[model samples]
Target: MTNPTANDKWFQDRAVEQIHMDQLKRVELFNGRAAMLGIVIGILTEAITGSGIAHQIGLGALVDGYAACRTQFLPFCF
Candidate 1:
C-alpha cells in the first residue's frame, strides 16, 4: 500500500555528506588562521625578549656580543 521507491534515501544521504564536508572545510580554515596567528605572536615575543636580553649584554662589545650572537641568534633563526 506504500510506495517505498518514492521515498529514496539517496537525497538524505547526500545532504548529510554535504553538511559534513562543509564542517570539515570550516575546521581546516580555522586551523590555518590559528597557525598564522601563532606564528605572529611567536615572532613578536622573540623580538621583544631577544632584543631586550641582547641590549643588556652589550650588543656590539665583541666578546660578549659575538657570544650572544652565536648563542641567541642561532637558536632564534633556526
Candidate 2:
C-alpha cells in the first residue's frame, strides 16, 4: 500500500500503534532518538579523521578564550 488512509486498519496498527501516547514515554523516546543521532554524527566525523570531532574542527582556541571566565575550565588541552 503506497498511501494508507487514517481510517484504514493497517495504518492504525502499523503507525499509530507504535507511538507512545504518555508524556514520559514520549520524552524517553525523543531522548533516545537524540542520543542515537549524536552517536551517529560522532562516529561518522571520527571515521573521517583519527581525532575527535572537536579537535578535528580546531575548537581548542575557542575554549581557551573562555577558560579564564570560569573557575572550572573546559578540558580541551587535557
Candidate 3:
C-alpha cells in the first residue's frame, strides 16, 4: 500500500508556529487526546473490577436499582 507523504518543510513550519500561535487545531487535538486517556482509564478500571465503568465510580447502585425497577415494572427506579 502506497501512502502519500506529508511535506516535511510545511510540517516543520506548522509545528514551530503552533509552539507560540496556539490555535483551535491545538485545542481540538488536546480534546481528542484527553478523550482517549479517559477511555483507557475506563478500560483499566473495568479490567481490574470486572464491572462496567459506571460501577467503577459510584453509580453502580443507582444503575442496578434503575435496572431492577425497569425489569420488575416498578414506578420509581431512582
Candidate 2 lDDT at 44 equals 90
Residue range 1-78, candidate 3, lDDT tens digits:
533355767788889988756777788899999999999999998998799888888666556866657676456655
lDDT of 1 by residue, 14-78 (tens): 88999999999999999999999977776776587774433444653333546656677444433
Indicate the worst ten consecutive residues by lDDT in candidate 1. 53-62
Residue 16 error for model 2, in Å?
Answer: 21
Models 1 onward score TM values of 0.55, 0.41, 0.50
Please give the RMSD of candidate 3 to the true structure: 11.0
Q: Could you tell me how far off, in angstroms, the CA of residue 24 lies in candidate 2 after the best superposition?
A: 0.8
Estimate the lDDT of model 1: 0.69
A best-first ranking of the candidates according to their TM-score comes to 1, 3, 2
Question: What's the residue-level lDDT of 27 in candidate 1?
Answer: 100
For model 2, which pairs clash?
none
* Runs of candidate 3 exceeding 4 Å displacement: 1-22, 65-78
Per-candidate alpha-carbon RMSD to the true structure:
9.0, 11.2, 11.0
Each prediction's number of clashing residue pairs:
0, 0, 0
Ranking by lDDT: 3, 1, 2
